[model samples]
Target: MISPRVNTRVWQRSISLLSPQAAKTESNVVTKERTYIENLSKDIATSRFRLVDENGKIASITVQPDIPICIKKDCLVSIHNLNHLSLSYKWLNFWSNLIKFRSFKSSLFHRIIGSSVLEILAAPNFQTSRRPFDSSRSLSVLNLTGTKDWNVFGKDSIIAFEQNSSLEIKSPIFPSARSLVSNSSKSQLPRKFQILNGRGNVLVCGGGLVYSIELIDESDKILVNSRNILAINGQ
Candidate 1:
């Protein structure tokens, strides 16, 4: 005859060994990491310029007509100009851009249509290539604070910028005249670099991936290929 306490202990042990334990579930757990493009969208959600799509191949930018935006004529996809916005063309570096860049697309200019929402898309022809690291073609947005100037490479890559902002086409500054003459023969050197200023947003199209890097100070310098560079802070 087993004692009552012994039987209770045996039963408890058997139950503990037979039953499965409940898993602790967390309600606040994040299963996936958000992409950088999503983060970029959030940062400028309140601004007039919004990044609609930037999925490595095709990139799109949506613009609200609070202010006029200058866009490349070729990149214009659609516009809502029921009566609010207006469209016009202006010559920007027409002859120089045509000769230097060997492309007539950048020579022509198109302005935002009246009181309209604009959609601009850029789909580089080589986007389908099987290159492992092809971040050269993509789209990026720059939020200008009216403080420092910015230098934009490949004027053709410039899809649009706020009309209130100022863009000046200038030649690249060399350390000295000798360096400029020596590199004149180099086909890789950009014939012109567009200097951007004022407070607004700039939409730039790159060859592959569009990303940003911050240099904390003068000590935090980085070397990147000129061809791959889209924009740089003039400071």
Candidate 2:
């Protein structure tokens, strides 16, 4: 018996977000017009399970801390709107979007939009930040408010916004994305810092703010209370 690498995966990710619900066109299984919706609002905590449909690119979803866990297998999972509904099933591998049981409340940017933002899918890694990661830094993580509401992300993942929300990444290139991943809690204060994985090609504003993102593989993720962030160096 062997084990997989810490953050490594064994399959190609079919996609980032969950797939659309399609009705079973065959007679071998139950058939129904699948409706989409967000079943819960709190946090999600569960175990790791695999799905056959999604090619294993970044599969393997784990819900350790249960704040807004979904119903057991074969149950109705209710969400606020159909659009918020992303992942659903008795088992899932990668949590492309917000679909966990554990949730940490954040009022800092709440009510500013249609809904409160949750978890944050951290952008590429940046050098240790140069600006003070506090209330001022909070504005950095607020991606554009287009058709994509920021509250959905807020509910699923925690932005590096809280103070002390730092972690030791596997490479120096990662921590460099600090400014891009900044939050009131965790941030790389050194404006002199550099951007690691520059597929994003991001730059810090005079006030330490950014208005764009390139998007890349920001996979190996974590969410500790910003206050728990200690020092981040070569891990």
RMSD to the hidden true structure, all candidates = 17.9, 20.3
Model 1, global lDDT: 0.53
In candidate 2, stretches whose alpha carbon ends up further than 4 angstroms from where it belongs are 1-135, 140-168, 173-207, 213-235
Question: Across residues 1-235, which tens digit of lDDT does each residue of candidate 1 receive?
Answer: 6576554533333111110012232121111112333454475432355454434444455665555666666555455444666778866666666766777777566776445565545444332345522445555666665557777777576766656524343433331222112234432434356666755676776765565554443434344576776777744
- lDDT (Cα, 0-100) at 164 in candidate 2: 12
**Top lDDT hit:** 1
- For all predicted structures, in order, the TM-scores are 0.59, 0.15
Q: Positional deviation of 92 in candidate 1, in angstroms?
A: 1.9
lDDT of 2 by residue, 1-235 (tens): 3356543352342222212122133221111101110111122221222221221111112222221222212111122332232343322112311123222121111110112222322221112233222312211212111112121122212322211112110112122333326345454433222112201111111222222221224543444343322122222
Task: Kindly provide the TM-score of model 1 when superposed on the true structure, using C-alpha atoms.
Answer: 0.59
